[model samples]
Target: MRVAMIGQKGLPAAYGGVERHVEELSTRLAKRGIEVTVYNRRWFSDYQKKTFQGIRVVTTPTLHTKHFDTITHTLTSTIHALITHHDIIHFHGVGPSLLSWIPRIFSPHTVVITTFHCIDRKHKKWGGFARIMLRLGEWSTCRFAHKIIAVSKTIAAYALAVYDCTAIYIPNGINPVKPITNSEQIIQNQFGLTHNNYVAVVTRLIPHKGIHHLITAFTGLNTKKKLVIVGGGHFTDLYVKRLHELTHGDKRIIFTGFQSGAALHALYEHAALVVQPSELEGLSISLLEAMNYGRPLLASDIDENREALSDYGWYFKSGNSADLARQLKKLLATPRITLERRAKIGQVYVNNLFNWDTITSDTLHLYEKLVAVKPGKKRRAVAAAFRLAK
Candidate 1:
C-alpha cells in the first residue's frame, strides 16, 4: 500500500514525540513492504535527502512562523498527497488533522487516518486565535477522518467524552537501547557530567514542558549534583533564553542543546535520576526512553505522567517548585541500589506493555482493513455515521 504521512516535524527525529512516532512507525511500515512517503517541513529536515531509513522523504516549504509552520506545511502536504495517488493519507496531531477534511472532500478514494497526539491548545505556546483553530481541528478530526488513533488512554477517553466518538487506543512504543560502555566518558566530554551525579531532563524547551518550574526547583536546592537539560527550543527562543537566565550563575546546571545517538544514550544510561515535569503530555517518549534505560524517575503529578509511570517513580505536586525540590531531595538521598531496583522493575513493565513490533503490526492491520473497503461504500458509511453523530 502507498501511504503519505503528514504533520510531524520531520524524521531523523531530532526532537518532539510526534516526530519520533512518525519516524519509528514509517520505518517499520516500510520494512513490512508498505510504501511510505513522509511529508517534511524544509526547515526541520534536510531538503537534499530523498529518503530516510528506506522511507521516502518529501520536503515542502512552510511559512516558518510559529503559527503558520505546521498548518501551512500540512496544507501543502495534503495538496501534494492528493495528486500523489496514495491509498492512505495519514495525518498526525490535531492541528494537521484540521486539514483531513480536504482529502475527505477532494479525494474520496483515499482513506484519511488521523492520530490525536495531544490536546495541543492546552500548550502555552498558542495564542487565542491558534487555540480556537486547534479546538476546531479536534472537531474536524472527529468528523472527517475515517479512523482516529489516540496515543494515550486519557486522550482516548477525552475524544469519546467530548466528540461521542470511539477512537482506536494505540500508545507510543519504545525501542530498547544497548548499554553505552563509555557513558562516563561521553558525559564528561560533552557536559562535564560525572556518572550517577546528575539529574537529566530530555524535552524541548517550551512552557507546557514545565522546564521553568524544574529550573526554579533545582536552583533553590543546595546540591552538588548537576541538572543537565538535553533539548533545544522549537520556536520558543524567548523561553529558552529565560531558562538560561534562570541558571546564569549556577555552574551545576547544564544545558546541552539537543544530543542524539551515543551522547543521548549515555546521558540517560548514566543519570542518577531522570526528571519529567511537563504539565501536559500525550504519552511522553522521553519518559519511556528513561524507563528503558532503567533510570529512577521523578515527574510532576499530572494525570498523563501518572498514567505512564503509575507508582513506578516518585511524583510531586504539579507546577509547585517547592514540592519538586522536596521530592528531588528525598529521591537523591535514597540508596542507589533501591533506585536501580525500582528502575529495573519499571523497565520490565514498560517493555512488556509498549513494544514497537506489536504497535506496527496493529497499525498495519488497520491500514489493510481500511484499504479493503470499497471507496464509494466507505464514504457513504462514514458520511452517514458523521451525520448520526451530529
Candidate 2:
C-alpha cells in the first residue's frame, strides 16, 4: 500500500529523534515493498524533488518563522498530499496536528495516523502562544486521527489523561548493534580525549536539557576530568556563550557542538559514560543509542527514562547537580568493565523492547486495523452525518 509520511523536516535526518524515526521506518518499509513518500521543508536552494533510498522526498513551501514553522509546513503539505491522493498519511508530531482538521476535508480517502512524540505544552521550551498552540494542536489531532501512536506507556497515559482518547503505545526503535572498531583511538585523537578524562552528555543545548546542572555537578566533583558536551541547537550559540562564562575558562568542560554519522557513533563508543540530563523526555532515542553502543547511562530520574532503562541505568535526582555529581563520582570509582556490564544489560533491554523492525511491523498492523472496515459498513457516510450534525 502507498503511504505518505509527513514530518516537520524532510528525511536525511540531520538532527532530531522524530526525523531519525521517519528515516529508519520509511526506508525499512520501502525495502518491504511498501511505497512511501516523506514531506520535508524546502530549506536549501539545492534542495529539489528527490528520492532517497526508495522513499520519495517531496519538498513543500514552509514559513521559517520562530514558532509557526510547523503550521506553515502543514498547510502546504496538506495541499500537496491531497493532490497526490496517497492511500495512508502518517503524521509525526503535533505540529502537523494543528491542521488535522483538514485531512477530513482535503483527503477523505486517506487514513490519518498520528504519532504523539511528546506532550508539547509541558515542554520547557514552549511559552505563551506556543504553549496554547500546542494544547489546541493536541486536541484537534487527537480528535481527527483514526489511530494515535504513543512513543511510550507514559506518553500514552499522558495522551489519554489529557485527551481521553484511545492511543496505542508504540515506542521508538533503533537499528541492530554493530561494535565500534577503533572508536576509542579515533575519538581520542579527534577530540583530545584521554583515558577516563571526561563524562559525556549527548543532548541538544536547551535550558530544559539540564546541561547546566551537569556542568555544575561536574565542576564540583574534585576530579581533573572534563565534561564533553556533544550537540548543537538553534539556541546553541546563546547557551554556549553563557556556558563559557559559567565554566569560566576552566578548560575542563569542552563543547564539541554537533556530530553525526561516524563521528556520533565514535563519540558514544569512546565516552567514559553517557549522561542524559533532560528535565523531560519521552523515551529518549539518545539513551537508546547509547545503549546500542553498550555505554553505561546516567540519566535523570523521570518516569519516561526509568521506564526505558528499568534498573539497567544509574539514576540521579532530576535537576539536582549535587546528586548527579555524587552519582558520577561513585560510578567513576567503579571498574570500566562494570560500566561495560551495565551497558550490556541496557543493550539487552533495548534489543528486546526497542527494535525498529518490531515497531514498524506493529505500526503497520495498527494501520491495517484502522483502515480495515466491513464492506457493508458505511463508515464514511456515518462520519459525514456526524460532522453535519456537529
Candidate 3:
C-alpha cells in the first residue's frame, strides 16, 4: 500500500525528535515492501536527493518562519498529497495535523492517521496565538484521524482525559545501540572530555527543554566533571543566549551545538551520566538513546519521563534548579560501581522495552487494519465531529 508521511522537517534526520521519528519509521516501512513517500520542507532538508534508504522524498515549499513553517508545509503537502491518491496519509505533530481535515474531506477513501507526539500547547516556546492554534491542532488530530498513535502512556491518558479519545499507546523507540569504545577522542580532543567525566543532554535548545535550569544547577554543583549541552536552538535565540549568560563563564560548561552520528555515540558512551531537564516530553528519544547506551540518568520527575524510565535512575523536581543541583551533587557522590550497575540495568531495560523493530511491527499492524478495509468503504474517524463547521 502507498503512504504519504507528512509534517516533519525533512529526513536525513540531523536533529529534532519528529524528524528522527519519521526517518526511522519510514525507512523500516519501506524495507517491508511498502511504498512510502515522505514530505520534506525544502529548507529543512539539507540535501536535494529525491530518495533516501528506499523511501521517496518529496520536498515542498513553505514559508520557513517560526510560526508559518510547519503549517504552511502541512497545507501544501496535504494539497500535494491528494494528487497521488495514496492509500494512507500519516501526519506527525499536532501543529501540522492542524490541516489534517483537508485530506479527511478531500480524499474520503484514504485513511488519515495522526500521531500525538506531544502536547505542544504546554511548551512556553510558542506565542499566545500559536498556543491557541496548537490547542485546536490537538483537537484536529483527535477528530480527523482514522487512528491516533500516542508516543507515551502519559500522552494517551491525557488525550483520553481531555478529549475523551483513547489514542493508541505507541511509545517512541530506540534501535540497538553500538556502544563506542577505543576512545575515538573527538569530544576529548576538542572539549577535553573523558570517560565518566561529563554529564550530557541531547535536545533542541528551546525554552521548554529547560536547559537554563540545567545550567543553573550545573554551575553551582561542586563536581569537577563537565556539563555538555549537545543541541542547537529552533527559533529560540533569546533563550539560547540566556543559557550562555547563565553559564557565567564557567569553563566546565560546554555547548557542543548538535552533534550526531559517531560524535553523538562517543558522547553517549563516555558520559558519566545523561540528564534530561525538560519540563515536558513525549517519551524523549535522547532519554531512550542514553538508556540504550547503558548510561545512568538524572531526569526531571515529570510523569512522562517517569513512565519512560520507571525506577532506572535519579530524578529532580521539575523546574527547580536548586533541587536539581542538590540531586546532581548527590548522584555525583555515588560510587562508580553503583552507577555502572544502574547503567547496565537501564541498558537492558531500554533494549527490551523500547526496541525499534517491535515498534515498527506494531505500527505496521495499525496500517494493515486500515489498508485491509474494503475498497469504496471509508472508515469513520472515531472521535466526535469538530464543533466548527468549515
Against the true structure, whose lDDT is highest? 1
lDDT, candidate 1, 314-366, per-residue tens: 89999998999999989999999999998899999889888888899999999
Task: Evaluate all candidate structures by whole-model CA lDDT and list the values in order.
Answer: 0.90, 0.80, 0.88
In candidate 1, which residue pairs get closer than 3 Å at backbone N, Cα or C atoms, i.e. clash?
A: none
lDDT of 3 by residue, 1-390 (tens): 899999998989999998899999999999999899999887775778889999999998899899999999998888888997798999998998888887766567788899999999999988899999999999888877878999999999999999888899887889897656555477778668888889999999999899999999999888889999999998989889999999999999999998888889888988998999999998899998988888889999999999988888889999999999999998889998898898789888988899777899999999999888832433442122333323
How far in Å is the alpha carbon of 263 misplaced in model 2?
A: 1.0
- Compare candidates 2 and 3 on TM-score and give the better one: 3
lDDT of 2 at 26: 90
Ordered by TM-score, highest first, the candidates read 1, 3, 2
- Candidate 3, superposed: residue stretches over 4 Å from native: 180-182, 374-390
1 against 3, candidate with superior lDDT: 1
Candidate 3 weakest ten by summed lDDT: 381-390
Q: What TM-score fits each model?
A: 0.96, 0.93, 0.96
Clashing pairs in 2: none
Residue 45 deviation, candidate 3, in Å?
2.5
Ranking by lDDT: 1, 3, 2
